[model samples]
Target: MAGRGDIGVRIGLSAVIFVLDGPGLSVLTTHAQEVAPGLPFGPFDPTRHRTFELALRAFVTAQTGFRLGFVEQLYTFGDAGRDTPRAAPAGDPARQVSVGYLALTRDALAPPSADARWRPVESFFPWEARRAGRLPLIDEFLAPRLRAWADAEPGERRRRRVEALFALEDDAGWNEAAVLDRYELLYEAGLVAEAARDRPEPPAADDAPLLGQPMESDHRRILATGLGRLRSKLRYRPVLFDLAPETFTLSQLQAAAEAVSGLRLHKQNFRRGVERTGLVAPLGRTTTGTGGRPAELFTARLGAPEDGHAPGLALPALR
Candidate 1:
């Protein structure tokens, strides 16, 4: 292991926390006055902090005032020149290596700081969400542009990738877990701000499509990594309960799944899947505030599982 002095690499921690709200899955974000919103990010202090996760939890709480729960390390970002645009740490000129994390919560806390706020996840990746059905930006704009780029390429690999990731062909289906892949493709095509920032020259077209809102630094890329990890984890883990309330209705549970996956599920089918897994149990209570008949409330049975997997019916493949 390299000591702190061996390599001038400063470790940092960044988190992408998602909360379900009226609009759907929203992320906790922060920024200075008149600056682009970014994930809760801060440098990890080796002296005062014992572990990297502890240091991350402390800074995130101090900055956002939202306590993190069920945080898992997502990835480590260490590309040079990516952290240049942001405020550098005080010390020697060093490479900033950030350990990214993903956390989920049921409540959206008000940021005590004036600069912090909650922004909808779809705002950063407009093309990823499918709750609105067909997206004009994808069908009308992104498809044509990406198709053109794929055709210009010399090999079948690029075309195949575009088709699979973007769901360009009629048979090809969209994969929510491929969030990072999709983002990297957009960056390579010069559709995103990070691509332009990384390249020696600006994108060829002055009218290049600003794919989505950009973060201050490579925070957006880190966010994509978190998003992809969460989506993929839904398949094998019961981590989704971290985003659910202590007690919630079945419809509410379905809504949470839909919000995170960005897919509108068939109510009956979803309920059937949930039942088959025996993941939830009735609370012996019903609420009538749903604007219709009273619906039964259910709570996730965290202890019911014999093996380690919890039934997560959020993704389409689960159905």
Candidate 2:
């Protein structure tokens, strides 16, 4: 029996969580008044603003003093009571729904303004570690509980869920783009602290630290949405260019792909694939100072198709 006023208006606000490569996959984040001192909150106001996109542009510029580029919608989260309690204004019945977005930009830009940082994404979602080889944490911690859930069901449905989540059929493999699904599954099973509700006492600290560090609020979840989108979109779009340097060696490009995808890629095969996609062309430049070998420089092809007009370079299979 909700009235017209009871129903919250659909408000859109864009957020970008950039993945910066250094030692690992890092997320660029900002601290607003809620998370940091001496920060204004009015910049995020959706009302009296024409579009969330414009608001986002102003928000980032105000907070970090850097203009963002190559942006896209990440996800929309509208779960009731999801915002921090302390920040909710009195009599503000409207649910604070946030429309998350992701963007890829050059890392050469200066560090974001104070209270913002680029923290390793693994710091928040360690279960995403497919970098080394096998996911031992998954096999040890999540598998037991997941199997139990599957066991509760009777047949194909159970098998399908198990196979999809664990990537078990024929030893198939893990897919990194299922970030949101994986988090939701973990939440449903009470594997993450955020999933806990109506409990008299908080659950004990998880012994398995496979999942990354939890963010201040649902920022981590929003980040997962962005990561999933970027991982999938890069396969069919040339958006990877946004994150690349103006000129890069093939190895550098490969490394960027590997960092974003969270998987190892074959060197020769990856280069061949990139060349075949017509996404990059040689810049008639070569550098021999990369230590032991000479490397040719290349740049991403200009005027590449946007919104899936042209096929993107095929990424090497994840190992």
Candidate 1 backbone overlaps, count: 0
Q: What is the TM-score of each predicted model, taking all chains together?
A: 0.92, 0.84
Give the residue spans of candidate 1 off by over 4 A: 1-7, 85-87, 90-92, 206-209, 317-319
* Winning model by TM-score: 1
Candidate 1: worst 10 consecutive residues by lDDT? 83-92
lDDT of residue 232 for candidate 2: 89
Global lDDT of each candidate: 0.81, 0.68
RMSD (Cα, Å) for all candidates, in order, is 2.7, 3.8
Error of 1 at 19 (Å): 0.8
